[model samples]
Target: MKQRLEADKMDSAQTVSAFVQTTRDKVSVINNKLQRLLDGYLDQLIDQETYKQEKNKLVSSKKSLEENLLTLERTQTGWIEPFSKWIDQAENLPAVAECGTLLEQKSAAKLLFGSNLQLSASEASGTAQSPWDFLQETKNSFKNSEIFADCAILEPKVGLEPTTCGLRYRCSTR
Candidate 1:
């Protein structure tokens, strides 16, 4: 996963570099064309109207290219680091499940499940689409093991009586 992330980051960097270089080259070509247009107008080789029209077109293209280059430079390095951090943290879910507080666990569930979490009178469950789905599947295999017992439980109940968290409860009929 780390290798894949590094490869993805490298690919993104290369793509951005290529994009910026291409835009700079295009701006250079447009500047040359503008200079040639000015020379033609001065030498009376081209009429005023033709010069204005051609210059406007070249100037617009140059502005667009410059904007694209700026945008690419500013945003290209933004998402990769955060994304890599997320992947690193995601790999430690079991530890988080083992030691994290209830609030932390719920936050992790929110991150993993997004809007797929559901709460009702009997259950608080996240959809199976979570990246943790494999963990859920294997949990039953280790149910009897002391180290795995707590982590194996996925859903918590939503009950009429609230717990300290104010929403969840662990209850069974007497």
Candidate 2:
């Protein structure tokens, strides 16, 4: 996703830069024309009124193009803010899930699940919204899989062993 966004930004920056170059080329042409007009007036090849009128038009056009160049440059960087914000939030999510206070966890859950949270069958169930839904489905799919059979070994000890604790992990023939 980051790569995709970078590619998009590169493509747009190239387009904006191309336009700026074209505008600059036009300004260069206007400068040349203005210089020629002055030479023509000095050599009596054109009238003073005509030269003044032509110069004014070129100056006005050049100013407008310069302003547009500034605008294009300013707006090209606007994509960074949203991208940075997404990165920050995504990176912070796991930490919040693990150790953040109950309020923080609730806020994060609501952010991900929206109004889809539920307590069906006395189990926490929800349809995660949009992108997060895919991750939630992935987690659910792995919940019953035996591939990570050792994961429970890492669960922190919390209290005295319950009567059912030994019942869950029994030696069985494969």
Whole-model lDDT per candidate: 0.75, 0.74
In model 1, where is the ten-residue run with the lowest total lDDT? 165-174
Candidate 1 deviant stretches above 4 angstroms:
114-123, 128-174
The number of clashing residue pairs in model 1 is 0
List pairs with backbone clashes in candidate 1.
none
- Kindly list the per-residue Cα lDDT of model 1 for residues 1-174, writing each as its tens digit: 577668878899999999889889889999999999999999999999999999999999889888888999999879888867766766777788899999888888777777677888877776655455656565667766776423424334445654345423353311
What's the distance in Å from true for residue 104, model 2?
5.1
> Per-residue error at 121 for model 2, in Å?
19
Q: Candidate 2: TM-score?
A: 0.55
Which parts of model 2 are misplaced by more than 4 Å?
94-98, 102-174
The estimated TM-scores of all candidates read 0.64, 0.55
* lDDT for each residue of candidate 2 in 58-131, tens digit (9 for 90 to 100): 88998998898889889986977787666566668889989999999888888787966789788766777876
Global CA lDDT computed for model 1:
0.75
